[model samples]
Target: MHSFSTAVLALAASATVVLGHGHIRRVVVAGQTYPGFERWANTDQSNDVTWSFTTDNEGPIEAANVNTADIICHQNAKNAPKSVPVAAGSSLQVVRFNTQGGFEHPGPEMHYLASCGDSGCANVEKTSLRFFKIYEKGLVKGGMADDPDWNMQKWATTEVHKNVQPEGEGFIDTYTVHIPADIKPGNYVLRHEVMGLHRAHLGEAEFYPQCVNLEISGSGSQQPNGVNPMEMYHASDPGVALDIWVDLESYKIPGPAVSSVASKRDIESSPTLKTHARDIKHWLSKFMA
Candidate 1:
């Protein structure tokens, strides 16, 4: 049987990318990386990982790696949930982003702006439900547009939110994002929002807005000149992608032993580490049709 690769799918030429899910357990981990990130928890993505869970209406579960998550948290302990000491009823305010996944984005496309309070302020109304607007390309509005790139442009909800969940140890939020799956490879912001919170005891409502970025990339690529793998899969799988790879150990295409892409070939006839070319035309034809 011909071998194949089962690793995470990449539709770009780059090796790595990120998403902004700011799984911040602490606040200080948001603004920028420095000493503050070292105190409570390590924002270092050395170990912790993320997976995929989505459906047509609820869940289309898949164990795929996703872009990291970013959050708008308080800068005290590096994304820690445990509460810190406050001045009996004092005030603390700051703006920051906590990165959770892997995409290295340029920056947030939108911010949490409050209409009743102005730029960075919020209303202390009786029931603190706030209004928000989505900003894109430099235009501030409430809708989305299709970019020349196939990637998705804005937030799309399949079902209206009937209810909001109460806070757990900290803020508990959820969202439904729609990715075109054909957008240009790199980190792109998928979701952002401004939410209101009211402390009945203190009579203060805090707005915590958050954003999430996405990363789309190709598994690997080679120089010389050929079709972009990502483009081949932009709309349809387009059958098998064509590629040239040098294999020294013809017994197996080099990579992790488990990589299904590993192929067993005869070294004597093919030569070691020779740049051999092949095409996944079989798979491409189906998509083309």
Candidate 2:
């Protein structure tokens, strides 16, 4: 009896650790889903576009490290060796994994793009990359209520499999962003980030950033100016350090304004688009040709 009780307690503790954090599981480009680096497995992903991280456990780069290179991606991030072809003005989906639940932290999601130039993003210098904000969403509705949908977390991190029972089956959440139609074709690094501000009032905002290599193909020729990734946010920035628990009128998202060339979608009215893998493959072949 004593041993069984100990085993149950141990299982609960393990479950807590797994449910505490989340990571990217895969990315869908032009309807084709590419697997993200499996940090938990630490497997070889030489052909994958998502950058690899050193640790198996998913964690955030604290706000204190905002000025460091670790903030650009996660800790000890390695650039991907390949880039995936994505057409301009197409939707890119990022699927997140939490094992048994949705992303519990409330915050905003922001996407940036850094041109890798003629050399490409596969081996580009991490510090030399200049990133411009392409998309940002925060505080969909302003109010002082406990309504989950009104908060940024619901807008960006809601659970997709709420009906799945037995806990850990299909715990996935998806966020989509469209490539700007007018941007020039080139190799670019897509930086997708989510800021968890639950502890911001306590001076410990969390940043989860991941990078993907993309070869954009299009005839558009507008390249927006970018800022150094390290300079994108400061510890004291109003958006970086703020309390979301109290009655709030509005919340500002950190970083530069959305680029002029970005494909703007209305979060309030736009329905989440879904695509078939077969159709995506057909379209991609013609687009690349």
Q: Which model scores highest in lDDT?
A: 2
Off by over 4 Å in 2: 1-20, 145-155, 158-170, 266-289
Write model 2 residue lDDT over 184-237, tens digit each, in one string.
Answer: 999999998887666676677888898988899999998898999999899999
Tens digit of per-residue lDDT, candidate 1, span 61-108:
111111111122121112111222222112112222233221112111
What local lDDT does model 1 show for residue 157? 16
Q: What are the models' TM-scores?
A: 0.21, 0.79
- Stretches > 4 Å off in candidate 1: 1-171, 189-191, 197-207, 211-213, 217-289
Q: Rate the local accuracy (lDDT) of all candidates.
A: 0.21, 0.72
lDDT of 1 at 281: 60
Global CA lDDT computed for model 1: 0.21
Q: Give the top-scoring candidate (TM-score).
A: 2
Cα displacement (Å) at residue 284, model 1: 57
Give the Å error, residue 160, model 1. Answer: 7.3
